[model samples]
Each structure stands twice: as C-alpha cells, then as structure tokens.
Target: MGKIVGAAIVSHHPGLMQCEEFRRAMGAGEDSDLIAGYSRLRAKIEAAKPDVVMILDSHWFTTGYHLVDGGARYTGTYVSDEMPWYLHGVPYDYRGHPELALAVEAVSRERGGYNRAICHPGLERQYATLNLIKHLRLELSDTPVVSVSSCQNCEWQHFLASGDAIGEAIRRSGLRVILLASGALSHKFNGIDWKPNHPRLFHESNVSSIENIQSDKGAIALMADGDHQQVLERWQDEYRQLPWEAFGAHYLQMVGAMGGRECRAKGEPLSAYENARGTGNIHIWFQP
Candidate 1:
C-alpha cells in the first residue's frame, strides 16, 4: 500500500479571485473568498509534491438514487427509488469511462423504471470542481490527476471509498498520495435572514465547532450516536451565539468525513475573511 504523505481540508471560498496569478490563469475576477481558497489550495497541493491528490468538495455532486451499468455490470445506490438520470444519457462519450447511455439503460433495466430521479443541482457543483481541476491541470505542468464527485447517498461512505480508491491508485502509480477535502465551516445561503455584520462571529463559532468535533466533545458527539436532532440543536445554539446571517451546514459533513479517516492527521484552526460578494472565507486544513 502507498503511504499517505500529506492531507489537507480547505474551504473553496472565492478568495482565489484576488490572487494575480490565479486571475491571469482562469481569466476571471475574484468575487468571493471561496474562489481564493481554491487558488491557494492548488498552490498548496503543488508545494506538497504528492504523486496523486484527492480533492473532496461538497458542492461538486448531487445526491441521487440510481444505478448505472458499465458494460459488464450495473452499479448504483439503492437508497431511494430515485435514479440518477442526470448522469444517464449524455451526448459525448469519454473513452475508457462508462458510456452515459449504457449506464442509464443498465440502471433502468436493473431498477425496472424509466422514472429517472436526478440530483441536478448537485451535479452542477461537481462541474465547478471539475472546472477548477481542469484549470489546475492546465496551469500546473501535466499532473496526471483524477477527479470524482462523492456519491449523494451516505456521503461518509463515499468519502471513505474515494479515499480508499485514491490509496490504491497511488500504490499502483508508485507515488506518495495527498488528500484534500475542500469545504467550509458554517455559511448560510439562499437569501436567509441570518447575516452577521462581523465575519469573526461566524468564523470563531465554526472553528470552535470543528475543534469540539475533533476532540470528540461537541454536537457531533450526538451525531455519532444518531442523535441528529440534538446535533442540529447544538449547532443552532452555536449559531445563536453568532450573528443571524451565518448559515451552511453541508460543509460540516465534509469535516465529519475527514475526522473519520483512520490515517488522517490533526486539523488546524482556520482564519476567515470577507470577499467581493460578502461571502466569508472559512479557511481550514487537516494534514496526515
């Protein structure tokens, strides 16, 4: 087995828009700290010099229930009857990868249904991450990178599986591996009324939460016991301490996945900053 030489968990905030180097490469203006976060993240990966890097972002893929066939067999989630139709049929075919149509067709046959349920919004996020990876590959010399959006169902399982796959792939390539979980602390979107005037309030609260979780002493403690409500309540209580506008829990799942990794290293406290669109940057990292 290949050794995990380095690991990191970072927020994909738009702060990358500010970096002159990133702007020239991506030909885009910096809008939020999330973008800047990704830019800095890519730099960090290059510096780490890992043979392979695995990036996990919550925004990249949607959660769906469906199966896809890869010539020999069908593979998909069976949680809900909802199938991942968005990935079913596509116009373009990528060589060596599953054909969209075949995969969808196989899923239809196995699931006995044409009612394709899709996680469209989730796929869009995945596409964004893909776009970032493409840019990174193009800008940095050919890095032989592979990307995969975590499955929608039981994200933790998918996270673990992805890590395992990366470990195996690295061993085959005979290179050290680095894992990066790209996400945020707490951020509220969707026009929610909760907006704290000071970014520090949100940042401090989230950092505290993460610290608590890492130490096995916070709301996440309840989460481990399947006490979801209590977990939410605890998070809500933390939110209450901060200004109202801070909201976004999906990012928390990413952190939870990092904490679960057996070979994972300790996480460090992250700083926060505001960007062009008022989106706060919650910078975090975990190393192994």
Candidate 2:
C-alpha cells in the first residue's frame, strides 16, 4: 500500500528568495535559519526516497473546491505578482503525478468531499510550492511533485476532511509520498510605516507582538511533543484568532491527512523558530 514516508511544516517567506547578503543584512548579520534548514530537510527527504512530493500550497487560494494540479508537466519562468522584484524570472521545470492527483479526487468524491484535479495547461503556479522546490533542490532530482490548493471558504473541519481523503488516496495509489505544509503561523504583518523602526526585520523582536510570538511558540511546542490534538483543540479558541497565514489551512490539511487528532508523529526542529515580517516561520519535520 502507498504510505506517507515523511511530512513537514516549512516556511516560505519571500525573504528566503533573496541573496545571502541581502538576507543577512535584514537578519542582523545572520541568514535566515530556514535557508540552512532547507539543506537539512533535503537530507531527510533523500533518506525517505519518496516517489512523489505533494505541497499543500497556502497561497494557491481557490473558492468552493480544493484543487490539485494534475498536469503531466509544468515548465516556465515565474515572477511573483505579490513581490515581483524579489522573486522574479525564476525558471521551473518539473513533471507532475496526475495519477495520484486523480486518485485524491476520486477518494474525496467517495467521501462526499470536494477535491478536483485540474490538468489545464494554463493553471498558474504559486510561490508557496515553487519556493520549496528551489530551496529543497528538487530541481536537481527527478522526483515528481504536485500542488494542492487551500480553499479560502473552507472552515477548519472541511480542511481536515480534505486531508483525510488525501491520506486514503495516497494509500490506495501505492506511492510513497512526502507532504509539505507550505506556509507560516501567526502571520500578522507589520504596518508599512514600521520599516524605519524595525531595521532588523527578520528578528523575533520584529514579530507583530509578544502575544503572537508566545502563541506561535506554544503551537510549536505541541508539535514537538506530538500533541496535534491540543493544537487542533486550541485552533478556534486561540490560534485561529491570530492572523495565521492562509488561515493556517496548509498545516490543518497536512495534519488531517496524518489522521487528524489521532496522529502521534513527533516533529524534529530542523530550524529555529524565526520571524518573517511579523509571521512565525520554521521547519519542523514529522517522521511517518
């Protein structure tokens, strides 16, 4: 049977796309730990040797239905409309796993959930998926990859259901997979006028507030302890109140696929928790 070999919640902040000098300058003479964390994550993924890597892309927002990229091949140059100058003219070429994606669609339907695989040639790419590819050095390997979108209108439970369907589909497909939750936590941003006050932009001090930092750390601690149930329990009462990136759908879906509240996979800290323009970002790997 197909099984999940590895999973992780990784940061995809735009700053990581910049050159080392720029990153260091913004990080108070330190490159973002996430940059180095990518190399470490790469090592672990190589060891797992997954047949395919599926990224739950927080930025690839869709309405109503959760979409999966089912294209056979995608090759292009991309420039982020959100930050064109920072992430511009990046070339990407990768094969897609349409079979696995279609299977996910089938499983979702059988479960009365909405997951549709789209193989349209004109479907655009998002940085949440592309950034990880660049950082993880997926371009150097032949591993096929796919991107799953976060439904903007879905509530917490809906996302979890989608994940559960994804998990079942992976098992039936018999393809070992690595799922990457590509987004951040407590994603409230500093106001545009605050740049002058926050010279060291990437430091924890620059995070939106102390409360945000504390909330993020608390969630991280639970993941490290393999206490996903508590995180989900606190979602509505606590964490969800904060402006989590993409409503934290990336993480919710990833954990949902792992058996939701029943999952006991502990996370290893691949990188220290850091700040990205007031958002909480880190790399924590969960072995499967």
Candidate 3:
C-alpha cells in the first residue's frame, strides 16, 4: 500500500527564486536561510525514499474543485507574470503521477470529497510548485511529482476532508509519498513605498507588524510542539485573522492527511524564520 513517508511545510517565496548573489545583496551580505534549507530538506526527502512528491500548492487557487494536476508529463519555460523580472526564463521538465492523482480523485468521490484530478497537459503551473522543484533540484531525480490546488472557497474543514480523501488514496496505492505544503505563514505584504526606507528587506523587522511576527512564531512553536490541535482550534479566533498564505490551506491539508487534529508530527525547523516582503517564511520538516 502507498504511504506518506514524510512531509514538510516549506517557503516558496519569490525572493528565493533570485540568484544567491542577488539574495545576499538584498540581505546585507547574508543569503536567505531558505536557500540552505532546501539542501537540508532534500536530504530528508532522499532519506525517506519517496517515489512520488505531492505538493499542496497554495498558489494554485481553484474555486469550485480541489484540483489535482494529473498530467502525464510537464515541460516548458516559465516566467512569473506576477513578478517577471524577479523570476523569469525558468525551464522545467518533470514527470507526473497520473495513477496516484486519479486514485486520490477516486477516493474523494467515494468519500463524498471534492477532490478532482485534471490530466490536461495545458494547465498552467504555479511558482509555489515550481520554486520547490527548482530549489530541491527535483529534475535531477527520477521521482514523479504532482500538485494539488487549494480551493479558494474552502474552509479549514473542507480542506481537511479533501486531505482525508488523499490520505485514503495513498493508503490504498503502492507508492511512497512525500507531501510538501509549499507556502508561508503570515502572508501580508508591506506598503509599496516602504522598500525605499527599508534597505534591510529580509529582516524580521520588515515583517508587516510585530503582531504578525508573534502570531507566526506562536504557530511555529505549536508545530514544533506537535500541537496542531491547538493551531486548528485557534484558527477561527486567532490564527485565521493573520491572513496566512493561501488561507493556510497548504498546512491544513497536509496535517489533515496525517490525521488532522490528532497528528503529532513534530516539526524540525530547517531554516530560520525570516521575512519575505513582510511575509513570514520558513522551512520545517515533520517526521513520519
């Protein structure tokens, strides 16, 4: 049977897309810890020997369906329309896991879940998914990758139910999977004019507000303590107000698949918590 061998909540901020030299220049002589975090995350994933890498992409926002990219193969040159200058001319070639995606869809259907696998090759890719591939150097490996979209209208429970379907699918398949929740924590950007005054762009001080920083730290601490129950419980009252990246769907879905509030996967931080244009970003791996 297929199993989720490992999982991670990782940062895929566009800042990581820039070359190390430019990143160091922006950081006042230090590269973003996320740059090194990718290497360490790669080692952890390698040790898990996962046959498929499933990404819960916060950027792939769908409205009605919890969409899964089931394309047989993906190949193309990419440039971010959102920030073309910062992330451009990136070539990607990766195989997809159609069977596994279809299995998730099937399980979702069986469980009255909303997950749907779209096998069309023409579907566009998102930086949230591609950045991880580039950072992890996934093209050098034989493992197939697939991405799942976060439905824009989904509440925490909807995401959890969809993930429950995915978990059931994984349990029935033969592939070993590594789940990547690719996005940030608190995801509010600073006002445009702030950049000129803030030369130290990547520092935590650049994060939107001290409150956001504390909220992010609190959530991170909860993850480290393997206390997702508290995070989930406080979502509607405390955490949800912080505007998590993509509604925090990436993390909600990942933890949901691992048994939702009952999951006790302690997080081992791979990168220092940092700011990316006022957003809270970090890389943390959860042991399986």
lDDT of 2 at 113: 99
lDDT of each: 0.38, 0.91, 0.91
Off by over 4 Å in 1: 14-43, 62-138, 190-196, 199-261, 269-281
Writing each residue's lDDT as its tens digit, candidate 2 over 11-110 gives: 9998899999999998778788899899999999999999999999999999999999999888999999999967899999988999999999999999
* Cα shift from native, residue 230, model 1 (Å): 16
The 10-residue segment with the lowest total lDDT in model 2: 194-203
**Residue-wise C-alpha lDDT for candidate 3, range 24-131, written one tens digit per residue:** 999888888889999999999999999999999999999999999999999998989999976889999999999999999999998888999999987899999999
TM-scores of the candidates are 0.47, 0.98, 0.98
lDDT of 1: 0.38
Could you tell me the lDDT of residue 161 within candidate 2?
A: 94
Q: In candidate 1, where is summed lDDT lowest over 10 consecutive residues?
A: 88-97
Q: Mind sharing the TM-score for model 1?
A: 0.47
Cα lDDT for residue 272, model 1? 36
Model 1 residue 33 CA deviation (Å) reads 7.2
